[model samples]
Target: MTILQTMVSVMLAAILTDNYVLSKFMGICPFLGVSKKLSSSLGMGAAVIFVMACAAAVTYPVYQLLVAFDLAYLQTVAFILIIALFVQLVEIVMRKLLPPLYKALGVYLPLITTNCAVLGVTLNNIDDGYSFGLSVWNAVCVGMGFTLSLIIFAGVRSKLENADIPETFKGIPATLIAASIVSLSFSAFSGMI
Candidate 1:
């Protein structure tokens, strides 16, 4: 497929069917933590997408090169370091050029390093043995998945915030129930892959 087509597929896959937080369950904390508010969750989701795309774009080639050197076993550590450094670079750039976004996303940006979704996508790319284009595509898609889930979760939580949910089904309990449903709802997309 053309690069454009690949990009589109990746974007759709990430944002729609195979969502990271809902389907893969890679990022539950921020998905739940920042999701109490729609705007914050959106902010966090956007940040994750950016970081995921960047991580995949850079890590794919590095992973390929590392494999070439017969050092495939180092992928875990290498990916972690690469993602951490990239998040740092993004923090620096955001602080200098976009102070507002930095203020909004600064706290969460550091947290991205430990987010399993980001690392999961990196490792997933290697496991799938995707080409440079496809690896990056999947990574972006996975991030989109994360973003989509966060957006939906935020919306759900916002509406639920006003309701008088049962004692057992309040707060995180309700949130978890909602996520479970979302996960089940999105599982229909697995056939597409």
Candidate 2:
């Protein structure tokens, strides 16, 4: 297949068929933490998309070179540094370009710096033997998938604020139940790729 076809396939697969969070359960913290409101969820998701894409773009080439040199054991450390610097770059850009958005998403952005989902996408890209372009595309689509799930959850959570759910299944319980249904619904896409 052409590079374009490969990129598109990896991206579509990550977003629809095997989302990092819903399908693989890589980053559940922000999935549950910042999803209380749609606005914040969107912000968080966007930040993730940017970070993951850049990280994948950079790390795919770097890690593969390291592996070729028999330094594969350094993947974790190298990936950490790469993710941190990439997120820092994003933070700087956001702070300069959109101060209000930076302020609004201040805490969440830092939290995402260490998000497994970001690093997981990078690692997955390497693990799957995708080319650099394919890694970036997959990271982007996976980030979009995360955003989609978070936004929907946020909307549901907001409405459920006044719900009369049973006392035994209130708060996190309700959230988990809701997420389970979402996960199950997303499960249908497992075969699409």
Candidate 3:
């Protein structure tokens, strides 16, 4: 396929079929925690996108260097270190420029350092043998997919607040049910691409 076609395919696959949060279930902590508020959800989503893309960019070369020196066994360790540093940088920048958002995200910001989705995308890029450009594109697309799931679920949670429901399933249980339904819907797209 041409470059454009490849990019389109990757975007579609990541955003619709292979979503990190919805489909792969990689980052459910913040997906459930920060998603209670739309603003916080968006902030978290943006932060994930920025971190994932940057992590992919930085880790790809780091992994390459590891391979060059026959230290491929350290790929996971190296990737985690890079991800942690990037998350710290994002925290510093966000804290300075968007204090309110920074405050809203609070602990979730630091939690992103250990978010599996971010690490998963980076490792997948390496495991899948994507070239540098494709790796970056895949990472960005995965981030966008994560952002989409967060915003969509945040909207659902907003409406659910007012919806009458059985007392037993009112809070997290209700949210989990909604997320499961959403996941099922996402599964329908598996054969589309």
Count of backbone clashes, every candidate in sequence: 4, 0, 0
TM-score each candidate.
Answer: 0.88, 0.90, 0.91
Per-residue alpha-carbon lDDT of candidate 1 for residues 122-148, written as tens digits (9 for 90 to 100): 888878677887876787677667777
Candidate 3 shows a clash count of: 0
Candidate 3: where is the Cα deviation over 4 Å?
Answer: 93-108
In candidate 2, what are the lDDT values of residues 1-193, reduced to their tens digit? 8877777777777777887888899789999998998888988988888778888888987887898999999999999998888778778888999999788766677888779998888887888887676777788899998998889889888888898999999889988888898889889887777
Displacement of residue 86 (Cα, Å) in model 3 is: 2.0
* C-alpha lDDT score of every prediction, in listed order: 0.82, 0.85, 0.88
lDDT of 2: 0.85
Error of 1 at 35 (Å): 0.6
The positional error of residue 154 in candidate 3, measured at the CA in angstroms, is 0.8
Rate residue 188 of model 2 by lDDT.
Answer: 89
Looking at model 3, which ten-residue stretch has the lowest summed lDDT? 101-110
